[model samples]
Target: MSLFSAAVAGFGTGLSLIAAIGAQNAFVLRQGIQRRHVGAVVAVCVLSDAALILAGTAGMGALVETAPWALTAARIGGAVFLAAYAALALRRSLRPAALTVDASAAGPGGRSAGRGPLAAAVLTCLALTWLNPHVYLDTVVLLGSVAATHGDGGRWRFAAGAVAASVVWFVAIGYGARVLRGLFARPVAWRVLDAVVAAVMLALAASLVAGIPG
Candidate 1:
């Protein structure tokens, strides 16, 4: 196939995998709506995915196969991280003042926090990306294996396309969420959203624990 075709294939495949409503997307959506360090959050997510896609394209998938323990470690760490985060989200819902702050917070370009808040946001984003085993499965393994079908030159192009998709999708989710500003202007809405985030995070942790089963 031509480079263009390979790229299109990669874009579509990546979209299909990431478009699903998972922990990463949920966190992105929440950050987007909260308008707290959105640029940083989006950049972290996009860059992380790009790195993973490139690693997969570069044949890191084989290394992953030889190091199955890596994923197991990620799974355990991710679950703990996600569960703790879920509890935080749930706790936030109980604090009316927290949602009030979210409702009147800055725009997509606003600072969600400073010093401590920034550090927490960045740390959470990193944990959400690196701790998640599914990310390794889908990007490093599945996407990498799929890229091989396009041959050498085409595979790189495919990886590029996938990376592009990550950039586009994250930008859209992070910035596009601003359109719902009116809806999220209410503190109740923020609370509801937090509850949903908690549920999603817990669900993701549960799925990780279940895995493929014996």
Candidate 2:
């Protein structure tokens, strides 16, 4: 296949894998709506995806496949982290009035009074990306296998396309979420969003647990 075709295929596959409302996307959306450290959040996501894709292209997928224990460890860790995040979201949902007041007091970027510190947010982003076993399955195994089918030269093109898709998707969702700022201006909206986030996090946690071997 031609390099362009390989790239397009990779881009499409990458977008399809990540376009879902997973933990990472939910966190990005929340940060975006809060008008918080969106750049940092998006940067972490994009760079992480790029690194994973490159690793996959370099055939790290085989190593991951051989290590069943690694995935199990990641599954448990991811589930715990996600469950804790869900509890936090649920707690925040219970206090929409406080969120509203704090959000109103929030200053632009850097360190907003209402938003978590940049370091904390970045840490959470890293956890959501790295700890999830599914990330390994999807980016490393699946994408890598597909890229390999395109032959050595085309595989690099495919990987590049996948990385491009990550960049585009994160940037769009991270910034585009601000369009909902007007709606989230209401306390009820904040409550609803937190509630939804909690649900997504919990569901993802459950799914990860279910994937573990008996």
Candidate 3:
């Protein structure tokens, strides 16, 4: 296949993989709604996926595929991280907020009080992306398999296309949701969203612990 064709194929695969509602997407959407450090969140997600795609193109996917220990470690770490994140989300959902007597005084409170620290948001994104074995299978193994069909030069083009898709999608989801930021500003809305996020994290953690394939 030509490099252009390989890149187009990779882009399609990336969109198909990332369009699903998974742990990572849920986290990003939640952070976006809460008006957190959205740029940092998008950057971490895109860069992490790019790294994995490059690794897969470079043949690192084969090494990971052969390493059961690596997969096991990732599963355990992901479970722990998701569980902790669920707890944090639940806590945020339940926390009391200072009530404002004047309607004008009310603004984005709750999780939207202030943008989270950039470094912390980036670390959180990294943990969510890297700790999950599913990420490897999706970005590395599956995508790599597709790239491999195109031969050496085409593989790099494929990886670049995949990386581009990730960057575009994350930026859209992370910032585009700002259009509805007002709707999510309500405490009840925040609680509902956080609860949903907590459920997703817990479910993902349970699935990992059960050795269910991503």
Candidate order by decreasing TM-score: 2, 1, 3
Q: Write model 1 residue lDDT over 11-39, tens digit each, in one string.
A: 99998887888778887887787677889
Best model number under lDDT: 2
Poorest stretch of ten by lDDT in candidate 2: 101-110
lDDT of 3 by residue, 1-214 (tens): 6789989988988888987777789878866665577778888888889889998888888888899788888999999999999998887778536211122343345433453467887788888889988998888988888888889889888888889899889888888877767776576777777788889899999989999454
> Candidate 2: which pairs clash?
none
Q: List the residue pairs that clash in candidate 1.
A: none
Error of 3 at 149 (Å): 0.7
Which residue runs of candidate 3 sit more than 4 Å off their true CA positions?
96-112, 212-214
Candidate with better lDDT, 2 vs 3: 2
User: lDDT of each model, Cα atoms only?
Assistant: 0.85, 0.90, 0.80
State model 3's lDDT. Answer: 0.80
Mind sharing the TM-score for model 1? 0.91
Cα displacement (angstroms), candidate 3, residue 47, comes to 1.1
Summarize candidate 2's per-residue lDDT along 159-191 as a digit string, tens digits.
Answer: 999999999999999999988888887888989
| Runs off by more than 4 Å, candidate 2 | 101-112
